[model samples]
Target: MTLDLIYSTALLLALSALYEFNIRAWGQRLFAAQVCAGLIFGAICIFGMLHPANLAPGVIFDARSVILGVAGIFGGPVVAVIAGLMAGAYRLWLGGAGALVGAAVVTTSVLFGLGMRVALRRGWAQPRLLDFLMFGAMLHIAALGWFLLLPMQHLQKLLETLAFPYLFVLTPSTALLALLLNDLQEQRHAKQALARSEAMRRAITRASPDLLFVLDEDGRYLEVVSPEEHLLYRPLTETLGKRMDETLPPAEARRFQDFLLQTLKAGTPQKIEYELDTLGGRHVFEGRSQALDIRVDGKRAVVFVARDITERVKAEQDRRVAAVAFESRQAMLVSDAGTVILRVNQAFVDLMGYSREEMIGRKTSTLRSGRHDAAFYEAMWESVRKTGKWEGEIWDQRKGGDLVPLWTTITAVRDAHGAVTHYVATMNDISERKLQEEEIRSIAFYDPLTALPNRRLLLERLQRALTLARRNGQHGALLFVDVDNFKQINDEHGHHAGDLLLQEIGSRLGRVVRESDTVARIGGDEFVLVLEHLNEDPALARTEARQIAAKALLTMARPYDLEGLVYHASGSIGIAMFNQAEVDLDLLMRQADEAMYQAKHAGKNTVHMHGG
Candidate 1:
């Protein structure tokens, strides 16, 4: 019988692997998977019986109970019934006096195994080695009890020859296989679950945009994970296991080493910003570090995330400088390459007696004063074209049609390509002072040229609006407005007249927006509108921003009586819609600027919306 069951343990181990291979499919149809396993093992059990070493002419012995009992315990009632049928039917077909007893053994062992399985489900008990030993003994006893189905002589012969071996060897082997198979299944599942967890962690890390690192308190790199490899100053192999002092420059190394230690000590995150000379060139990086639940080389571990913020810092500095310039006493106007006034100071508004909006997009001729002859104006522009600057005294007409004398300087701003991208014109009043102190106070937070909020004030107000909108879950709009063909006025009518046109455009923008909104001059013919307290629905809010833009378009399109010349002008408007909680203000401004260029490309006098 032992020879007949040769390598049965090996077969059982192989079945453990089979169960694991189809574990997912089994999860969906556990009963079916179980029934299939039962049928396969049951057939193998039948083969084991067929090949059993004969103990007598009519009686036989094999480990059929091992297959049937295990199938029942692991697979439940359905598996038990199927496996019992195969084992019992094959035994009965063998046609011997002991066949009935053989069938009985298979059936009873299945029932015992099923009882334990149901008990496990009910939480009454857990499987124990002693219980399996008891179960194996009981199955043999059941088979022995049916010995009456054998002839008296056959039963006596079987008992004397095989009873001791069956009890000591077969029963113990059955119990051991059952316990071993159960452990194998559990271990396989544990490994599978662990694999899934690791995959999920890797997926999350891969999805992040920031540069990530794991390091020890001693500033040794443990791991580096990043979507953009160029941001890393050192290659992966070079950084891993290397100290910061070895991988980075002295200053940066010290900064990072201290940062990691501080993070470990605080047990909370710390933020820092530093610059690096990477393969991609110099970049400013903002980093935040948090202590991790780990230690390496007897040191606490920290997780650090770094993001590039070079462009953001540069843009902020530029805004601050522009803000300071707008707060100055000189009436200043900044125009883009398209000749549209992009910003202005409040002095221009007070000097011209026009609200900042009125003269924003009007031709420079609007303030011509008719003092300088056509030849004189041509010479001024020609000189600016060649020298990038022209400074002189001139007469400018105000909103009330009064001519005021002023000293002015116009400078051309060029990009790296040596192409003129902007013009900055500053005016210093030469006439007698009038309300000078009051003027200074009035223009404190306003552009001296347009009486609109200066850069500093506009940013504060915008930040507040954004916060309010976020709290209320509402929307806001930012517009970057450029006057189209504005340089034509400066070239033909004079810089003074171009300033007048800008004033007109600015005034019209103010008229079209809601009272709660803001219209401000950045410089030149460029204006910005902060439309606030808008609808929560994105589509509705977008429509409202567009409606206001259309109104500005129509209003600015009307002929302007710049010194009664009746000049026609238009606007190129770019709009960026945002929610307070989500938008970065710098990115929002860039979106608007990009949209404005889109409008310029689409033909001026139209509006363009930017996608976030």
Candidate 2:
């Protein structure tokens, strides 16, 4: 009996070796592997049963309890159920008085193994040698009670003889088998964890844009990891196991050596900005080096990471130049895409009469003069959208409520995608230029003394009026007036007083006419008035002209104050009514002059009409 049980124990140990090698390969397909494990456990039970320590005809004791319990804890409930069913079915096939009790023992062992599985999973028990021993002891204690269902003769004999060996030998075998499976489970988990960690490290190294290097304290390259081969000064085949002095220029090699020494001494990360002549081109790099915990080839090691920053360095330089140019003498304003002011230079502050604090964070509309309509501004911005620039004259208000004309150029600053990111405007104050232009125009077209339209301007206006009347079928009048006895007054009161009288007469004549009429001082002591938009009919037109002429005579008849001395002045007026039908401009002027002489002959200070 003892020899037969020894054979059963040896078989189980051999099966455990097979499990360690083949079972883990089946682990990926969990249900399939569990079913397979159940079959294997069932086979092992059958082998144990075939060679059991038989005390009766159909009753047997074997390592089925150990195998099923380990299956429940490791292969889970699936293996436990299949193994228990198979072993119980076979035991019942060999019918005897102990058959039912043997099947019951199988069921009780599976249930107890499942319970231990739950305890292990919830951390209530561990898969250790001692814990498995306790588990086997408890499972077999319950299994021993199931034998009570057997025949009284078999039960008494089995307890007296087999109980001690079953409890001592089989229970320890169960623990030893469980401990073997536990070691297999822990090894599988360790391998999986290591695989995942290695995969993650490889992924990070490949995905990184930086060039990674491992160097010794003597500046010898131990390893290099670069995703892009062109980023390296030389290929990895040539770079590895080489000193920096052998592969790089003296200055650059010295720089790397110094950096490596510093990283080792500091025991922390150190940073440096450097330039490298790579296969691609000369590039600026930002390098960070940290001392490693281990040594390489009998020397302290460091890991260096270099990131290319060529574009970033160039952009910073460009920004510095732009900042310097922004503070130039010309007034400049910068705003965001939303037209909210961001920055204004000192020149802009002086020109706008507003401090920098008041303008920042405010919209550009805050400086609007309201001189331009909405449509005008819309068109201006439209040009900037299409062409990226708008340049012209704009009227903007200053802080003191004065409007200034500025020749402004607005340029849109765009990003790489051609989206407007900011607006840069340069302005020049044109106020002085505007004043000078006005003075030039006044000199060309106006009288100096009376500040009225000169003869040149009068003739230009007269020509325009004739063309207008020709189109509208209306009559216009030209009145020519000459002061009475002006030569005598000039001889007596001097040219100054005579000049004063002419100025006053010009003023009075202007008061008597409508704003649309032209009151021009064509010569000394002579003036011409061009009246437009009179009556359409020739007869009514004549009457309108005579009425206006009589009013002008009365205005000239009023007393004039020359140099604070009251001087009475009078003038004779000649009226010539003409329509567009009159072709010759000189003819109209001659007729007005002839009528003026007629008034002078009839009596001074009187009015006469041509062909009346």
Candidate 3:
């Protein structure tokens, strides 16, 4: 039995060695090779070449427990189940008093090994050498218990004679095999890890854009790895194994040596910026050095990576200059090609009352005032595209939704290639200046005393109304009104009372006309009322014009209370009607003036028709 058991052990050991030889070729592939192994082991068990010890006429001792247990430990549940099924089914086919016991042995061995695998994987038990021994011992101990499944009389005889040596030899041998396999598996993993690490190192060296160099404490070049040879001032073949001072200029060599010393002393990393001449041009480089634990030729070394940053440095300087201008006092905004706002200045926040977070990624139309039509914007952008810039008054709404007027200058910021990458709009709030200009214009063209359009504005309106009336084949009239007895009120109540009377007259005349009509105080006690859009009926237009002139005269003639004094005033009005056929503003004014004298001569506070 001892010699037979030894033969079984030799077969198991031989198979383990042979499988290890081709383990890598199988590539794991999820039990592709493990299933083949399980089948071979199952065939060996069935042929009885491995079940070498006969315990009784129908009972045998074999390493089937070790085979399935090893499968469970290494091949997981899928492998264990298939292998156990194969061996157990074939054993049942053979049929004997010990067949059921043999099947139970296969099931229990796989179960015990699989349970240990799960516990180790779940960290319920640590995977150590002792854990392997304990697991292997469990599989064989379980095999001993399967004897009860056999006939009680035969089991008692085997237990009395062969149980001791069977357990003594099988238990340790199972543990020894498992330990060897686990060691071999660990060694295989270590070799895989080393190969992967070496591959990663080579990949990093090849993929990096920066120039890398390995240097000793004496600044001798040990290794140079550069993706682009044009970046190096000298060829690497001539510089390898030579001191930096021999290959580089005196100043640059001293700079490199100093950097090396600093890295070695600090035993950390350092950074520097330097310029070197290359075949392309004088290039700027940013270099970083890290102290290495490695030694070359009995000397400590450091690794240095130098990256060209000439264009990057120049761009940074340009950006700083632009930033100063971009963040100036004016409200400014910048947008991408699609007109989505990317940035806004501080002044924009203050002017528009919108925060950076609220505006970025939003369209510029968020602040649209709805004053300009779409055609206006289209034209403006077309101009900007053509000229690369445009300056004009634009209207935009504030964050509180107020329509704000702006004097904006937009510039199409182009890239070096002259492509419009972004648009910058610098705006100034022109609302206050516009309000001031409106006030100045009002003073220039309006009567200060009555806040009515003065002679200048009145003439302008007359010209426009006459031109429009002619174009539409309509009639417009001009009423020349002189306040009757206006001098009497000024003399009795002083000039202040006279001014008040004129103001009252202006208000009354304005009320009698349409909002589109104009009432102006040309001077003291004299004013003009321009009536427009009297329709196409010439006679009816003349009748309405006379009635309006009469109504205004009566309003002015009514008594006015001025500074707690009752004062009386009246106006003599002369009406003149014309169309585009008589389109001369000066001739119309003369005709109206001559008729005003006719009204004064006819009778005061009366209306007279001109050119009659």
Candidate 4:
């Protein structure tokens, strides 16, 4: 072979090697580049054969446009134009009548390339069998027209011999090869689409928070996402390939088994609600199962997705509890860390005689009375700060300027870290009980008629005085007094007038004694005085008793006007000094009573002393 033929043959071999390598390494989807390289090499072979000095120009074929046309249809315009240029330039260098024919082939290749380029620019380069056939016909027409027009007198017999075989054999073979290449390209594209779909499925399942699992018809776990570690707490590896009962608790596993069986039998999706224990807490999951047409690994299976609803369930329970608490009848107040009232229920507002707007944002101390000092509050806080609770009676003021007594229990609400966040106080009003207690005290200690302390209180005070005098080694005295001619005043002015005179006498008696003395009514028209810390001399006691008796007599003697009726009254006084011989309260009372009898027996409205 000539060097030019040898070189052209070598180029063809190199192009074929490149096409095979691209098909093996990069797959058939990128086969357009390989096809372009083959067309260019074929064009170079044709140019070399057309040169008489290269190989006598007899081996050359005028159908080189077919290869370039195929490249144009498949590999697009750029590859076609490049292959045509190489073929036209080699033919010119070879110097023959076929040079014109090669130039004509180049013109057709360029036209096809430009036309394909325009079509591609308009988005028409996509593979279609109709367009392929049209391109093949165009290549045949162009090559045959040029061949028939060529004037080669000596080559007519050779052309006739070659034309029939080329038209019948090479054209059909090239068309079949082009169709096969298109089929291979389509198969490669389909394989790529399937691979992408599988990759997308894997990515979606791996990233999903919801648990994705599959189980067999007999309720054995078949496949799971990331099927090694625990999705929540239970390891999927342990559960895999095991029967449902062996993997989970008996009840839960049985339920899952039943769901799987139902889905497999019915060929429809099934849903089940079950509780799952996780690191977060107990969660409620809605599991949906469906019979899968294809098994993951050759077992009849059901695919399932479990969605968590733990927060929604917990929120529903909390809402119910809050509803009950909000409608509770007891007076309740929720306060902030600083004791500012945040919420006050209807009962609290009604009990405290305040509106909701008036109470909220107000400090609890707004209801505090000056009765409890700072020490009392400090002790309360000491207990609260230590134990997170304080419960006691609090004297609070009402809006109407009346004291409201309440028994309150306060609890400190804390967060997860045990920091005090708020305070919840429940209060019960005890105002009615307090009022009743005051009424009972008044009835027990004060005389009903005179509003003065009765003899019961007087005896108690006299005993306290005796105790004090004994402790200090000091003298104390008790004075007993009786109204002189109290019956005569009743006889002259009726019992109403006598009652009025007695009220006047009680007032005058109170005026006669010092503020430190205890004056009490022992009985009708009889009174007692308790003298605390008196002078030791018995005569001084007598003198003080006589002066008080004189003052009382003068005040009572002047009170004669009563509803336009005139009346008069006087009193007799007796004084008894504290002594070791008569130290007890009863002895003091007896001695002072005997002295008063002595004074009355001696002269009315006079003063007398014991042991005189």
Give the number of the best model, judged by TM-score: 2
Kindly list the per-residue Cα lDDT of model 1 for residues 1-612, writing each as its tens digit.
554444553454455445445545566577678777777767767766766646676577777777777777876777778878988888888867677778888888788778767766687656677777877787777766776567778777767876776677657766787787678677867877898899998898888777889988788888999787778898777898899999999988987888888888898889999999887788899999999886677778999999889899999999899889787877888777666776667877766677667666755656688878999989998999999999998888877778887888999999989999988888888775535755775577688777788777788888888888988999999988899988899999999888778777778888999899999888788899999988899999999999999999999999998777679999999999888576787888898999999999998999999972
Q: Which stretches of candidate 2 lie over 4 Å from their true place?
A: 1-7, 13-55, 90-98, 156-162, 227-230, 235-242, 296-299, 414-421, 448-450, 453-509, 519-546, 557-612
Q: What is the C-alpha RMSD of each candidate to the true structure, in Å?
A: 27.3, 4.1, 9.1, 11.5
Q: Please provide the root mean square deviation of candidate 4 (C-alpha atoms, Å).
A: 11.5
TM-score of 4: 0.53
Residue-level lDDT of model 3, residues 1-612, one tens digit each, is 767776786677556654455466686564676776566556655554336577776687777787778778766777678778898997787666788888999899889878877887789876565776677666777788888677788778778866776677667777777777777888999998998898998789879889999999999999999888888878878889899999999999998999899999998889999999975779999999998887888899999999999999999989998899889999999999788999999999999999999999999889889999999999899999999998999999998988899999988989889999999999999989999999999999999999999988888889899889878888889889887766676677788877877787788888988888899989877899899889678889898898888788777767777768777776688888887685678888888888888999987888888877
Using TM-score as the yardstick, the better of models 2 and 3 is 2
Model 1 error, position 210 (Å): 2.4
In terms of lDDT, model 3 sits at: 0.83
lDDT-sorted candidate list, best first: 2, 3, 1, 4
User: Of the pair 2 and 4, which is ahead by TM-score?
Assistant: 2
**How do all models score by TM-score?**
0.46, 0.83, 0.59, 0.53
The C-alpha stretches of model 4 lying farther than 4 A from their native spots are: 1-323, 467-476, 489-496, 511-516, 533-549, 560-564, 578-582
Instruction: Give a tens-digit lDDT track for model 4, residues 412-488.
Output: 99998999999988888987888899889879988877778998888778888887777766666788879888888
State which candidate, 2 or 3, has the greater lDDT.
2
- lDDT, candidates in the order shown: 0.80, 0.88, 0.83, 0.70
